[model samples]
Target: MNENVSFYRDTWAEINLDAIEYNVKSMVEHLGGEGTVIAVVKANAYGHGDYEVACAALEAGADMLAVAFVDEAISLREKGMKVPILVLGASRPEDVQVSIDYDITLTAISLEWVKKAEQFAKEGVLQFHIKLDTGMGRLGITEKEELDELIQFAADSSSLSVRGIFTHFAAADELESDYTDCQFAAFKKLLGGISNKEWLIHCANSAAGLRFKDRIFNTVRLGIAMYGLSPSKEMNKELPYSLQEALSLHTKIVHVKKLPKGGKVSYGATYTAQEDEWIGTLPVGYADGWLRQLKESEVIAGGKRVQIIGRICMDQCMIRLPEKMPEGTKVTLIGRQAEEYIPIDEIADRLETINYEIPCILSARVPRMFLRNKSIMEVRNPIIQSHSASKG
Candidate 1:
């Protein structure tokens, strides 16, 4: 651990780079000469740190990287990553030149956007992928004629190169395959007779890649599954291989007190002790991405499950301790402590959201400590870094 990286607040997210590497390798092996894996590192690799995750994925045999926008691609480029990066979202006309300069691939959603981008590219070829809106009503060209026009326009443009074509899956995680089949069929129809071997034609995301193995696309965009999370609860059991979770949240008790019978806890006094009990205050709350709705959730302390009591506050929450635990005792929020573990799925279920949202929702205020080979490799404390830089 870095000397500057102190556990001062005792709340931080631990990122296991080894698990990430393993997951990517497993996915790549599963592809087994069928296709390549485009590791999706968007939204900071689902809030597990993009640069770190990208490096791990690439080291583990990922063929390419995908982000939500051009800025993300530029960020990785600035960090000296030279892998093929594709922006999966629409880019501003003004920012088209940046993509060209960085050799980053942008997604061409419309002919109007493509024509506008041509105006911005002063020199060199602007590489991009044509996004086909097969079923995902999001960004992409839906009509076949529009797609044809875009392809012709790109071919005519001296500064544009159509490097790939792809589409999004609307519900590939679901049990029913009718909609996915229709989407894949439409994608195939859209690319009908365009047999340019160099053009990358892909449609499978993490869900589609695992579930629909019969339909092999040239590339699979590994997203949620790359982070050791299932696409959905229903699809968990059907995974071809087991996934290892890469992120774990932890904090320590900052304060401890013995409350008498009928004593209230937290704001609104929603929880009251029926008998004399020990209470421990954690330094994590909704502000740290531990949402207030998790008040009913349990955390591990001293190898025991402790119930979070009362309303969760902005910077603190009270947990009913089984015994008088001293301040600074470790608490496991979303990982294994001793023999018990609190999974992200459980937290997502309580929040009525998907597992993807759980980690992404974690606030930047909480520091992230990266681990490799069961050892701490780097600790990123934004708050501490900002404070130290201000002094320097």
Candidate 2:
């Protein structure tokens, strides 16, 4: 073990901050100064590490940051992120004072929730954004009357300040524009009722901002795209700018052996060697987000794609090696090796999921190594940190 290394595991996730910065800059360029970009760093920046990605986005010219809830915003605040952060999800009435103390903006989903929040408000004004339910059946004010009432109520309350009004697009990633057009129309109709037009008006997420530049108001929430991923598989071809993926999963082969032709591998003996083949065991499994569903998935080994074989165990998995690879040979699970590459979308396809979930599902057991300009900047190992805290 290296003297400076704290984590014992060989499996790790690598995040390229340069790629994130590049992606953010590309989105800003795509906007052409017409609107501001609110870097969505919720869900730990979609599992890319919120603080690291948030700083990269801000450095790349993102104007604001947005998270899913109050706790996420507070976590950023505790990290000393002073950027304007909007909680896109509804916040609790009791947490209103906490948000105000931290200068965190929240979403006002309904008049009732706002009234409750106002009752809890103390000492400082609580700023919020009004959410309109254009078409999505999720949280927001659905009717025009309710929206006007909420708007007027905010205007009347001295403790509350409405900073923005926005809605979400349900199918903006699809090639068809009918649903998006309908939502935009509804948003416009709702906008007619509000007297304060200066509130930061925004309704476009990554998909809508990338596909429909004409429909954006003055801000766009940059989420998955800012991490260099398409909003959906269907929108891959429609992306205005080519995105550079920022995260890669990798591990070192800890053990290698040659299996006889009849030799079986892993838990269920589901895999039998067709020929005398070299097999490698990786120190990664379901606990590390390497699910059993990816039994036949391919990973880069020896500069070529090789299939994973047999039942995946809780702590390890086996892969068929093309040649005799020594222990500690680098294996690329979700990145490029030589001329071959395994994109996140490919993993998502194997699991029948979205690209966003791929990184988010990566468990904290795997240390994240952050990189900038191809050099490692920091290594965040949650396991080691927790262990140290327990020891202390």
TM-score of every prediction relative to native: 0.97, 0.97
Q: Write the per-residue lDDT of candidate 1 for residues 1-392, one digit (tens) a residue.
A: 24667657789999999999999888888888788889999998999999999999999999999999888999899989999999998899889888899999999999999999999999788999999999889889888899889999999889999999999989999985689889988988988868788988889899988888766568899999999999988898899999999999999999999999999999998898999999999989899899999987899999999999999999999999988998889899998989999989989999999999999999889888999998888887778778998999
lDDT of each: 0.90, 0.92
Q: What does candidate 2's lDDT look like per residue over 1-392, in tens digits?
A: 34565578889899999999999999899999989999999999999899999999999999999999999999899989999999999788999999999999999999999999999997889999999999988989988888888878888999999999999999999886589999999999988856565689999999999998988888999999999999998899888889999999999899999999999998878898999999999999999899999999999988999999999888899999988999998899999999999999999999999999999999989888889988778888988888888999
Clash counts per candidate, in order, are 0, 0
Candidate 1 lDDT: 0.90
Off by over 4 Å in 2: 1-5, 195-197, 390-392
Candidate 1 ranges with C-alpha deviation above 4 Å: 1-7, 387-392
* Candidate 2, residue 29: lDDT: 95
Model 2, residue 132: C-alpha shift (Å): 0.5
